[model samples]
Target: MNRLKPFYEITVKLAELLDQDINAKNRETIISQVNLLIEKRGDLLPEVPPPFTEDEKRVGSDIVLLNNKIQQKMNALFIDLKREMKQFKKQKKSNKTYTNPYEKIQTMDGMFLDNKK
Candidate 1:
């Protein structure tokens, strides 16, 4: 229906944004845009709309595929971030050891104290 055109267009734009190599600032912008569109779409959904046309279905499918790709990229990015964090922790620990290698060692010469009654 004509009413759904704006929703479709926004969905397509969201999918295109997901395809971009967006930085954090741009990502936040995209998130806000998507949130606004969701709110608008929700407002329009009070009435039961007709079934999607073929083109709309295709666009919906494209959105699904794009979402999946975005999820995959997020997973990969998380993995890389975790790996880097682990490496950074190891480096920090090694630096600490290098700076103070004997901090944890305990050395006590043999000595005995006897109490007299």
Candidate 2:
């Protein structure tokens, strides 16, 4: 009971962090914090604990929902990245074509004679 308070607090913090629109550096910080909390929780898991209270159960569900939101955000970012990459490739190809418009033309071999000989 007393020991679980810290764990619940950390879990709530993690959920709040995930819900925010944080930058990469802040996100890394949050990840490190979560990792530390996970390690600490892992060591404590062997001890038999009482059932979760209503509030604790609600916080757990909130964490799950936050994690899902984070996953969706990442998926959207990946999709946007792929779309931008495709646009970049198309632009590059168009630039190459513009710069080398005659690249497809085949050159004919011609003999050069020494007219001054």
Top TM-score model:
1
Best by lDDT: 1
Candidate 1: lDDT over CA atoms? 0.66
lDDT of 2 by residue, 38-82 (tens): 676567665526587877676667656665765675566457557
Clash totals for all candidate models: 0, 0
Pairs that collide in candidate 2 are: none
The ten-residue window of minimal lDDT in model 1 covers 41-50
Per-residue accuracy of model 1 over 16-111 as CA lDDT, tens digit each: 655677564576676676567667656755542658788767766766776676567556656755787799999999999999999887656666
